[model samples]
Target: MIFSEEILKWYRENKRQLPWRDTRDPYKVWISEIILQQTRVAQGMPYYQRFVAQYPTVSDMARAREEEVLKLWQGLGYYSRARNMHATAKTVVSKLNGKFPETYEGLLKLKGIGDYTASAIASFCFDELQPVVDGNVYRLLSRYFGIDLAINSTAGIKQFKELAKKVMSTTNIRDYNQGIMEFGAIQCAPRKPYCLHCPLNKSCVALATNRIAELPVKLKKSKVKLKHFNYLVVVDANGQTILEQRKGKGIWQNLYQFPLLETKEEMAAISLGQLKDLGLGDHPSILLYNERPMVHKLSHQHLYTKFWILRTDKVVAKAIPWEKLPDFPVPVLIADFIKRFKF
Candidate 1:
């Protein structure tokens, strides 16, 4: 009770005035929670606001095209989250009549709603006694309890979840959960925490032991796989370009991009012979956009990409005017190119 009281006091005085705060609307909470996952508040705020304005309700989102949703979500990466959110919106509109599930278990069954998100919505909007254990919670609990377990490890996850459940306040369930997470964000930060003035400093185990830097351990990630991507930027004489949609599963599914020619390994440069069958004639001009391949890093793989600009008089069958490029959804890598590359 004392710990919870201290956290709530600090929270009431120091919590940021975010748009999603003080709202019991489940849709708003759901959207905000999803955007904040693996994204910083400052980086995600504009997108959250845009999303709320664009799709004010589940029915609005369900009626929107997936391409439109992806375009709005461009540059934020982790496109799978947007896809799942769209699918869930359609599900809610069709099956649940635009109403979100009220219980943590029920929310968990929805697409893209994991334990953290479910707990967040369940407690914040539904007044359920579910606790959230996100990165902030994990860090704060690890240091305060002086636990040195690797947070990514299975045993560590279980131990911390059990601890969170035990410590979560029952009297002020929503406020307590929100306060603890807010405390972790501002006071018990990952680096350079304000331990000297922290509300829990007197009883914090890591501070007492002088091991704040090492308490929250995390195992090293596996080596990132390397991929060689060759993109063909085909522009006809009429200042039009060709694009193809990414089909099936895997990275960037259902997104638009220039015709790609993936290779097993990186190549120095591509010649006209390489574009032999890709609607290129003998006299077409081929130039490498970058002298060296651009390294675009994703969570699992590093894309060593090279965009080959091919201009020819050959009339492409499905070429679209370059002015219409912004209408289609593209990856951040391609979006950056479009910003710099002038026709």
Candidate 2:
């Protein structure tokens, strides 16, 4: 059976009833694509809806503050996406005169948009014959074709993308694109894929050869680097705590966090006065009360974090929006700290 036919048949019966799928609006499609990157559908859907509802147009998003955008994207991790979305919105409004670029190449020029995003926007919105190659699509194609190349490698990505484009039906690019993606997301899931019910099972090379898992190969990731962070939660008698915004191009840039001191490794000794070594301790009052250590994992880093609660009489100078900490939105990691420490 032809690849497009199998996908089309499966999509008609199993495609998700997504709002973005029902329309050809470039703006909505772009928003969905970006939010869905490194994010599950169940997780990305609410953020997509809220973003579309809050900022209907690129100009509206462009004019919004980064804090406001990040606030709306509080729970959703990979904050870089929110920042990129905000930056791209401003670019679209300013560079394209409030109009989303209409072609694949034009869309690719936008900040944060890559080949996959460009293809999705182009095919979905303009019916352009461009193919999207996300992890789902990669897995499906590799399994069906029995390709052995590492899917995450630079060369592997190029090869798979070429193969995907070759199989993409030009007659109805929009439906074809949506059909393949839907087929991958549902029928050809990464684990325990329903090979028996799959429309392409007859022609799937990986299934016939008993190499389903081995075919969709990926390069092993480097070991996660362990880093330690000591957060200071200094509170005045008014129940308000000092919060700081991370700066200078490291992880969590521009995001609000507690006063932090990063050490080479986890510190065995826990003391209030030790903060002076990290450029603290000058405050008039420093009463260390409680300490909690959390291990937060990211894709490339494992964060071993410890928070110290200290009582102070005044706010520190480096704190972010100190008077308006209540107004600023915080990530769950920070929110949990506030709830437990009680200022």
Best by lDDT: 1
Local accuracy of candidate 1 as per-residue lDDT tens digits, 43-113 = 99999999999999888999999999999998787888999999999998899888999999999999999
Q: Model 2 residue 233 lDDT?
A: 71
Candidate 2 lDDT tens digits, 301-320: 88888776666555445444
**Clashing residue pairs in candidate 2 (N, C-alpha, C atoms within 3 angstroms):** none
Give per-residue lDDT, candidate 2, residue 274: 62
Colliding pairs, model 1: none
Runs in model 2 deviating more than 4 A are: 269-292, 314-326
Superposed by TM-score, candidate 1 places the C-alpha of residue 236 at a distance from the truth, in angstroms, of 0.5
lDDT of 1: 0.89
Each model's number of backbone clashes? 0, 0
